[model samples]
Target: MILICKPGSPVDSAKKEIRLVEIEPSSEFDAEICSRFCFVSLDHDPLPRYTALSYAWETALTTEQIKVNGAALAVTPNLGRALRYLRKSDTTVAYWIDAVSINQDDGEEKLQQIRLMANIYRCAQTVCIWLGEPSESSPLGMSLIGGRAIEGEPHELLCGQALTTEYAVECAQALKEILSRPWWSRLWAAQEFALGSASVFMCGRQWFDSTQLIKDGTLNMIVSILSIRGVPAESLMLLKYVGSISLTQTTAIKRLWDLMPSQKPSGRAEIFCEILDQCTTKLCSDDRDRVFGLLGLSPESLALSIDATYDNSMTEVFESLTINLLRHLDSLLVLFTAGVGHPGDVEYRSGVRVRLEDPYLPSWVRDLRRPRLEWMFPPWYGKYRTPFNAFASKEWTYRYANNQLMLKGLRIGNIPAVGLGTVCQSHFYRPGEQADGRRVLQSWMALCDVAGRERGRDPYPHGGFKADAFCRTLYGDFKTTIIMSGRGDFNSVRLQASDVDAIVQSADWAEKLAQYSDEEGEQEAFSIPPFIIGRRLFVTDTGYFGNGGAWIEPNDQIFIIMGCHYSVILRPTNSLQSCTTYRLVEICYVHGIMDGELFDGVPFTGKSEDESTEAYLERTEQLGDHVIEPVCLC
Candidate 1:
C-alpha cells in the first residue's frame, strides 16, 4: 500500500512530504513479531529505562494475545539515528519512508489513505514523537511530573528526557521535510497557508518546566493542532501534556470542531464528533448540577462552531458566548470560595479591575470603545484597560490576611481572561498602622484621594458621597488613599485609622461617615502618619465640603472630626499554615466640649475612660468588631 495526498490544491512540487508504503496484511500476522519499533535517546544512563518499557509494552501486548490486523507498518523518515529498535515478526513488519518514496502503484487508494493520515497517526499503538533533549530545567520538573510510581522507569531513554531541547529543533527540521514533498503537497490543495503557518508557529515557542508554562503551551499547541487542516485527528490520541490539568469539556469540544472535517470526516473525526456532541449534550442536561460536571461550566443551549463553515457574521454568537463563559468562570471562582471557611480564603484583597468599554467586540474592528471609557476616566486612564486594586482583607483570625493582588485585562485576546486576565497584583498594609484613629477608614479615604489625583477619578462608589470628594481634594481626607497600584492602571485603596473605625460603626458606612472624620483641629489638607491613630479632629469647612462625588448641601456637615481606631489580630484556626494578622483601625465619632461647658460640668466627673491621649489597646478583646464579614463582589 502507498499513501498520497490529493494534489488538486496549489503547491510547490519540489518540496518533500511524509509518505509511506505498506505490503498487504497477512492472515498469519499472528506470528510472534520481534520489535517493530523502538525508543531512541542520547542519554547513556537512560538506555536501561527505554529497554525496560519496550519490554514492558511487549510483554503487556503478548499477555493480551494482541495480533496485528496486518503487516506492522513502520511509517517514519529515513533517520535511523533516532530509531532504537523495530523488530516485529522476524522482519515481517513492513515499512514506508519519505527518503525512499513509494513506487507508483495503485495511486488512488494511496491518496485516499493519506487524506486520513491524521486518523492513522491517532490509532497507532503510540507515535512516540521526539520530546527533545532535557536541559537544566527538566530533571526536577520531570520528576514531579512523572508520578512516584513511574519514577523508576527509564524515561530518559524511552522519552528522550535528556533531548527535549534538540527535539523541537529536530521536529521543525523534520516536519519541514514532511510538508515539502510533491505527494504531501497534494493535501495542501485548499488549506495552503495552514502548513507554513503551523510549522513556523510551532517552531517559535517551546514549553518551560513550570506547571504554568507546561499548561499554557499545551493549550496553545492543542489549539494549533486542531486549527491546521489535513492534520490527523489521531494526532491528539497520544497528545499528552506534562501537567495533570485536563482540558475543560468545552475546550475539548472546540478542538474537535476545529480539527476534524465534519462533512466527510473519517472514522476518527466522526467518532470524535460523536464524543464531543455527547459532551455538549451532557453539558446542557436538564439536571442543573449535572451540567457543570460535563462543561466545567454551565453550557448554553447550543454552540456555534468556528470553522470553514462559519461566516464573519457569526462572530456575534462567538463573542456573546465567550463573554458569558468569562462571566461564568468569574462567578465560579466566587462560588468555589464561598462557605469554604469563615471567609478565611475569601478575602477579596487588592487587585486590578478591567472593564471593557465595549464588551461586545470583534478583533478586526478598530477600538470603538474610546468614548465611554474616556468619559469615565481621564485620557491616560481611559479608552483602554485600567487596573485598580479592589482592597479587601481577611479577618485577622484567618491566615490569609497578608493581602493578595489580582491583575485583570480585557479585549486583549480571543480567549477572555478567566478572571479576564491572568496577572495578579497585590500590595499590603503594614501591621503597625492599626491604631484607634479610625486607621482603616483613613486607609479607605486615602484610596479615594489617590484615585482622584492619579486617574482624575475618585475611588468612591459610583453615585456616592465619597465620589464627591474627588472635586474637594485630589487626595481626599487621609483616612484612606487610593494610590497607583501594581495592578496595571488601577488604584489601590489603603485604609487609615479614621476610615477603619467608621467602616465598623456605620452599615452604609460608605456614606454616613462622610463628616465623621471631622476634627476641630482639622486643616484642609495634611498627610496622616502611617502609625498614628491621631485624634485631634479639626473643624472643617463642612459648610462648603463637597459630598461623595456629588454636590453637598452647605448645612450637611457642620463639623468634621477624627476618631481613634482599635487594632486587633485575629484568625480562623490556630494552624500555623495560614494565619494572616490584620491591624484594624476603629473610627469613633467625637463631639467637642462646649466652650464654657468643659469647666462648668454639673458635677466634676472623675477621669473618663479614653480621655487620655495615649495608645489605648483595650484590656478586654472586643468581640463585636473583632472579625469582619467578607465583602461579596457579585
Candidate 2:
C-alpha cells in the first residue's frame, strides 16, 4: 500500500492542503492488477511522516501505465519498480517521490516545491537512493564491503597487500560493476544524498550503508589495493575508481562546506566553482540544472538572488550565472575547467581551434552542459586548492557588460616553439594504449628537442643533456622508485625505478610506462608523475620556458593578467580598427616562473657553453618593455 500527496494550498499559507492517494496492495504479481485511489483534500491536514525517493528519473525508461487512484497514470518503469518495491502489503506507506507527490503540470507549484527541496530532504526520516536492479556484482560488492580482509585489519582493506587468489579478482570485478551504475552521474542526486540525515543506497533488494561506503580513507585504501595488484596507474579502470570515489568523497566535502562559518559575503562564485568541480560529471535533464541545482547549497544571499525560475533558456541562465559570478568574485578561476570547445570538436589540438558550441559565448566562458572524459586538474591541486586571486595586479581593471569582457594585462612574449598539439592524436587521455603511447613519447621527445634548441639550452633543468634529463623534461618524474607490498611472493617489495635508463634500456617501456609498475632497486630523487595531462610545452621568443595548452600554436603570445597566478595564452585577431583584440586561449604553467618572482630577478639565460649562448644573449637583449593595453575577449 502507498499514500501520495499533492499540495493544493498556497506556498506561503499558514494552513496547508494536500490531496492524498490511498493505494491498496494486491496479491497479484502483475503491476496492472494493483488498485489505487486518489483522495482529494477537503480540509487542511497535518503532513504525515513519509520517506523520500531520490532517483535518476532515467530518460530512457519505458512508460508503464498503472492505475493511480483508479485513473490511468503513466510512470517510468524505473519509478514503477521503486513504487512496487517500497509499497507495504497491509498498511499504506507514505512516500514523497518527486514524480508523483508534486503536481508536475503546475509551474508555480513546481517552483515552490523545488525551493523547498532542501528542507524536504532534511526533514524526511530516510532517503532511499535507488540504483536500478542489482547485478551479479551487487551482492558480491556488499559482501566485500562488509567482510573482506586479505592482509591488514578489515578497516585497512585496500591499503595493505591482498592475496593474489581468485578472490582478489572477484573483488576487483565487483567494485568495477558497483561503480558503473548510472545513479552516480545525476546532478540532482548529489545534493539529495548529501542533505539526507539517514541515507541508504539501494540497488534492487540489496542496500549498502552510504556512511560505510564513504568512510574516511576509503579512496587511499582503493588506490593502495589497486597499486598492489599491479594495476597500471594510468589504466582506465583505475581512473574509473578515482571517479567513483570522488562521488562518495563529496559527502565529507559537502559537510565541511555546510560547517564553514558564515561571514560577510564575498561572492558565490568561490563556493559555486567548488560545487561545479564536484558535480561537473553529473548528468542533468535540462542543461540549466547544471548550474541551478547547486544554488541551494550556495550562500543564502546567492540563492535568494537567483530564484528558481524555469522560464529562462539555458543560454540565458548560463549568461546570468557568468555575469553574477564575475560581479561577485574578483577572479576568473571559474574558466579554468573549459574543455576543447564542443565535445565532438575535442580532437583539435590547438586551444584556438577548439570550437565553441555557442558563438555568442564570451571566449573566456566555458560551457558545462556536457561531460567530457578528459579530466581537468583538481581544484585542490592549485595554490591552496582554493580560488586564487585572479586580479593579478593593482593596475588590473575589468568591465563586463553586453556579454563582453574588457580587461588590461601585459603581453610577455610570443611562442617560438610548442610541444605536441595533441596527446596521442586523440581527445581522450589513455596513455595505456600501446600505439598511442609510442606516438606520445615520440612527439614529446621531438618537442623537447625543438624547445631545447630554441632556448639554446638543455630542456632538463638537471642531468644536463642526458636521456634521464629528457625523461624528466618529458614525463616530469617517472624515474623515482616506490615501496609497497608485493603481489607475487615477498611480503614487502619495492616498485622499480622508471628513470631514463629503465625506460630506454628495456624494449617494453611503452607498455611498462603505461602500467608504471616497478620493483625497488635504487631510488633517485624523482617527483611524482607530473599531473601534466592536457599540457603543452612552449618556449617564448625570449627563451623563457613555460607550458600552455597543446592547442597553442607558433606566434601565440603569453599574457600575464594582473591577478592570475597562471599565464594565459592569447592569439591576436584581425582588427579593422586601431585597437587590438586578443582571443582568450587556455591558461598556462611556465616551468620556473609561475609565481612571477622570476620575472624581476634576471633575464632568461641559456645554459649551453657553445656559440648558441651568444645567440641566446642577443635574443634576450631583444626583449622590449612590457606593453599594457585594454583588450576585449568575446
Candidate 3:
C-alpha cells in the first residue's frame, strides 16, 4: 500500500522561518531512508548549520518512496539515491534539500522561500553537489579529480608531467563520463553553487573537494596532456571528446566558480543582463525560473523591485523584467536580447513574413521562453569591448506606453537585398546533411557580387574590395581566441590588413576542403563562430554591407539608436510614406558606420564660414536629412 505524504505546517514569513530535514541514520545501504522536517528561524542567534543540497531536478514524476515524519513521501529517483548515500549510520544529519524543505504545492511558501534562497545556501555549513548515482568508472573519475591515478596508482596527469597514452585515454574517458552528467547543465546548480560559502561534489559512495580540483588544476592539466603531440589514435579520439565537453560544459561551471561570492572581485556586483545572457543555454523546466532562478545573483533584482511569485503569467513576467531592465539600467541594452520573433513565423530566402507581434508579448519584449541568438555586440565588460558607438555618446531617451517602445534615433536606409540565411551548425559540420555550409557561404558571396554590380560599384562603396568587406562582416570584425585556461575570449579588434588577407585565404581553403573532404575534422578546420548560426548576410540601399537576423528582408530600415552599441533592424508596420511605428526585427552589424562615421561631416548648406557652431547645430536639427526623432516599436 502506498501512503501519501501529509502537508507540513506553514512557514512563518514574518520571522524568516524555513524547513530543514533530519535524515534518520541507517546502518544498511538498503535500509529505508527516513527523514523528518523541523522549522527554524533564520533570525536565531547563530544560524542553524546544515548541508544544502544542490542538484538538478531531472524529472518531476516520483519513482521512489521515502519515509518522511512517519509517512511515505514520493521523490525522484535521483533525490532518493542522494539521500541514501548521504544518510550517516552513526547519527542523524540535517539537510536543506529543496525538494523536501519547501512545500512544492504551496506557491506562496515557495515564493517566500525562494526570496531567501541566497541566504539559505550562504548560511549552510557546506553545499553538497549531488551528481547522481555512480557508474563503474565513477570512482576513477573522482580519484583523478582529486589528483590521483586509476585505482590509487601514482600518475602525473595532474602534476604537469606526461602520462602514458593508455592512461591518458582511460582518464579522459572517465572524466568525460563525469562532466557529461545532467547536473552541469542546470541553472539552479550554478546559483546554488555560487551562493554557497563552501561546496563539495558527491557521486554515490565517492566524493571530492571542489577546491582541490581548482588548486591542482586537474581540468587544465588534463586538457594540456590530451593535446600533447604524438598521442595514440585512441587517445586522440578521447582528446576530442574531452575537449568538446570542456569547452561546452565544464567551462560554464568554472566561470561560475570564479564568480562565486567568495572569489569574485571586490565591490563588483554581477550584472543582471550578463547573467541572463550566460544562463540562456542552461536548462529549467519552468521558463519563468529563467528570471526568478537568477534573481538572487543579481542585486539589480532588488533594485528593480522584482518579486518572486508564480502568480504572474510567463509573458507578463518576461515583459515586466524587460521593462524594468530598460528603465533601471537607463540604456537600451536590454533590447539587444529581444526580437528573436515567434517560431511560427516563416523565413524564406527571398523575404520574411513575421507575425508582427507576439500573441503574448510586444515585439519589443524579449520572450525568455524562446531560444536566443548570441548578442551581436556584447556588453562593455570583462574581455569584451564594444567597438561601435552608433549614437556617438548620446544618452538613451525613450518611454513605454500601451505596449509600444518609443525611441529617438536616425534611420539609416532600408535593406535593398538580402543573401541566403545561415543553417544550423549540424548541417555545416555533420556529413550527409541537406544544406552544404560551403554552398550557403558561396551563395552569399554571389549575392554581394550581384548587388555591387547592379549598383555599378565593383569595389564596395566603402573603398575596399567586396570580398574583404564580406569576410570582415562575417566575423563581425572580431578575433576570437581560446585563452591558456581553455576559456573562450573575444574582443572587438579592427581587422588589420594582414588579418583581412588571412581571412580571405581561409575562406578559399574552406571552399577546397568542402569540395574534397567529408571528414568532420577536416571540415572543422574552416569554421565560423557559433554566434552566426542563424544570421543572414544583407546589403543596405545606402551602400553598406551587414550581417542581420535570419528574418531580415528587403525594405527593412536600420536605425542607430542613441546609446546602443550596435545598429538595429526595424520593420515598418504602416505605410512607407508616413510610418510612425515598427516591429523590431533584430540587432544587426553594419560594416562601415560602426565608429560614429555616419555623422562624420556636415557641409553647412548656404551658410557663411563665420556662422557659430551652436547656430549651425540648431539649423541642422531642423533642416538636416538625418534627423533624430521618436520611432515607436510595437
Best candidate (score: TM-score): 3
Instruction: Report per-prediction Cα RMSD to one decimal.
Output: 24.5, 10.3, 8.0
**Top-lDDT candidate index:** 3
Q: Compared with the true structure, what per-residue lDDT tens digits does model 2 show for residues 248-303?
A: 54564466456433533433444556566667667789887876777656555555
Q: How are the candidates ranked when ordered by lDDT, highest leading? A: 3, 2, 1
2 or 3, greater by TM-score = 3
TM-score per candidate: 0.23, 0.68, 0.74
Candidate 1 residue-wise lDDT, 201-292, digit = tens = 11001222211222334334432433242234344232332111122332333344344333331223233323323242221112221211
lDDT of 3 by residue, 1-634 (tens): 1112344788888888778888777767864787788877777877767789998796656478887888777778888888888874367777889988898889899988888887788788999998889898788777766544543322353434455666666667777787667887778887787777678888887777666543324455556666573346565456455544333434454455445445332222224455565566678888889878876676544433676678888877787777776655555666666774424344354574444346677777876655456544422334123656777665445666677776666777788745334533432345443246766666666666632333222577657676666666764453543111101323223445575555445535345324322333243323343455666778777667777766776788988876676788988888553337888877788877677766667432433478653333223232145766567788
Q: Residue 56 in model 1: shift from native, Å? A: 26
Those runs of model 2 whose alpha carbons end farther than 4 Å from true positions after fitting are 1-49, 65-72, 89-93, 134-137, 145-173, 214-271, 307-311, 339-344, 347-360, 370-397, 416-529, 577-579, 591-593, 596-624
Q: Who is ahead in TM-score, 1 or 3? A: 3
**Superposed model 3: Cα runs more than 4 Å off:** 1-7, 89-91, 146-155, 158-169, 214-271, 300-304, 341-361, 369-371, 375-384, 418-536, 575-579, 599-623
lDDT of each: 0.24, 0.54, 0.64
Screening candidate 3 with a backbone cut-off below 3 angstroms (N, C-alpha, C), the clashing residue pairs are none
